[model samples]
Target: MSDARAPASVEVEGLTFHYPGAEDPALREVAFRVRPGERLGLLGPNGAGKSTMMRIACGYLPVPRRRGTKVRVAGLDVATQSLAVREQVGYLPEQVPLYQELRVREHLEFRAAVKRVRRRARRAEVERVAGLAGLEDMLETPIGRLSRGYRQRVGIADALLGSPPLVVLDEPTVGLDPNQVQGIRTMLKNLGGAQTLIFSSHILAEVEALCDRIIILSRGAVVADETVSAALASDTLSIEWGRPSSGGGGEGDAIRGAAVQACLEQAWSRFDAAGPLEVELSVVGDRVQATVVSGPVALDELAAAIGAESLAAGLPLVRLEPGRRRLEERFAVVTGFREAPERAKGGRS
Candidate 1:
């Protein structure tokens, strides 16, 4: 039985699943909760069980009767009351499924009927969702003739037919054009405070923009779970400096690198009372980049220490930035993909 006073809009406990002939479980003891009206993002590399988890949450996959998989939607146990749980959730799978032959309005109306929305209320509900998804102008267009963006919107509208409290979207903007992505992002931003949203996306910036909190999955297990603010507020200092003009040859470069390393080590030693600090130094072209990883420390203090030490070593500092660790970088580090894809100069599109 679910607790009547449960504060979460969605809850999962000890959830695990395996395919009939698979050697390992697709999901292993995954657990998390979403409070009412909270937007959460799920991130992971391929085969990380993100889609699997979303499927279970949407009741598309059933939990084994004796496996003790516990999931609830809108305070209703999903395994025990699948239909009721479905009524409280709007799910958009990675692949937007739609009836190609049907018009947008026709498809939404059909979905509303299948979801058992009252006959008299179905039209109003369809219209409301259509408006929300920006399908008002193309409501009568055949779905097959619509663009991918329009098709995604139709899928979203179909999911929203019954005003479900929890909306789960998997890769809602995958393969979308820049304009289309922005449109969907705007819609989702508006929906955040009004709906309990759980979405998964490989686009780190998209997740950062739309989610309040993020849960990162790795090898079917939760690896990193934290608020967007905290995740972005990493305790690392980034320093960029100009390399010496004479440090062109390999030997010169090695010597310069060692000097920079020594400078950082000396600066870090100033905080001997504070724990250990790790430094990673690399030379990109003629520029030197140094990253100092340590526990939470004042950015200004650390920057001052590094500046003073570099001056003593005759190393020229170009820029010092704090908390520049991006969400994608953290994701890569946690998931063991240390070489995270670099973002373009301006940022993700």
Candidate 2:
């Protein structure tokens, strides 16, 4: 189920595959497009062929030699021009194979040579990549002795040896501390606007933070492909308020929600609205719990109108902030993690 619904940067058509000695095809009629300069996160549970697809993209695994079309990388035909396609793409596999005995500088040089970096600027090129990857300090350190983060950086440096337009990173941050993860994410975010990057990870949060869009694959097919903001924006709202205590709970304090709702209703009278907006409000100690539909009305205006009136009536005002119905919550809703009868929708809980 590819998103034939939108324009594509990379396109695949009628893709089918079966691994040697495997019982079934790893991929089946998979078709999707990754837009140019877009960071698309590939997500799936174990054994869903995410790695297989990445391998195909990198030319490690050959597409089935059949009459029908299959896969392509960077608009180059994978079936007929895989070699040329690979040259235009950079791949960092899960293991990040490197020569442990070689120093960081040496490993990069070796990779540069293998990638056919020109002789005239090889030295400067490795130095430049080392600086970009934050490998300057450890350039003289042996690859085997470096931490997981540093080793990953070395791998990335190698992949970026030629500054290819497309870079595929397979779980580049699989095992690293929080700081290291943030560092990598920051680096990638800084690099995103200039180059197209495709990264695979099981961590949805990482995808949420780094990728502009996400694609969830299940059973070798795309189940979701949407902009990261669109995905998160669907179920969340941005709310603003001041400290409740400052509003001075007046006589009308008890009817704050009702009053606010009424004010919104009055303001919305110009147009035939969609019934009432869905909102979840609660109070835990001093913090107000709110889940309101995001709209054009600025928080300052809503807060001023509601808070001023509420304060005059004896309620508190507080600052406003954006709130999210977390990614896991959205995932559960879409995937039906919890099941109930149709009547469940009618019962308020």
**Whole-model Cα lDDT per candidate?**
0.81, 0.68
Which stretch of 10 consecutive residues in model 2 shows the poorest summed lDDT?
A: 340-349
Question: Which lDDT value does model 2 have at 217?
Answer: 64
Per-candidate TM vs. native? 0.75, 0.78
- Best prediction by lDDT: 1
lDDT: worst 10-residue window of model 1 = 340-349
Prediction RMSDs, each to the true structure: 7.2, 6.5
Residue 298 error for model 2, in Å?
16
Runs in model 1 lying further than 4 Å from the true structure: 1-8, 66-68, 237-272, 275-321, 339-349
* Highest-scoring model, TM-score: 2
Q: Write the per-residue lDDT of candidate 1 for residues 1-349, one digit (tens) a residue.
A: 1111222388888988898899988888888888888889999999999999999888899965556668988878888888878767789998998999999889999999887788888888889989878889998999999988889888888877776778899888866789878888888877776778899998999988989999999989998889998778756678887876556767777788778888877887787676656666777777778777655557678889999998888888998877466787789888998864332221110
RMSD in Å for candidate 1, one decimal? 7.2
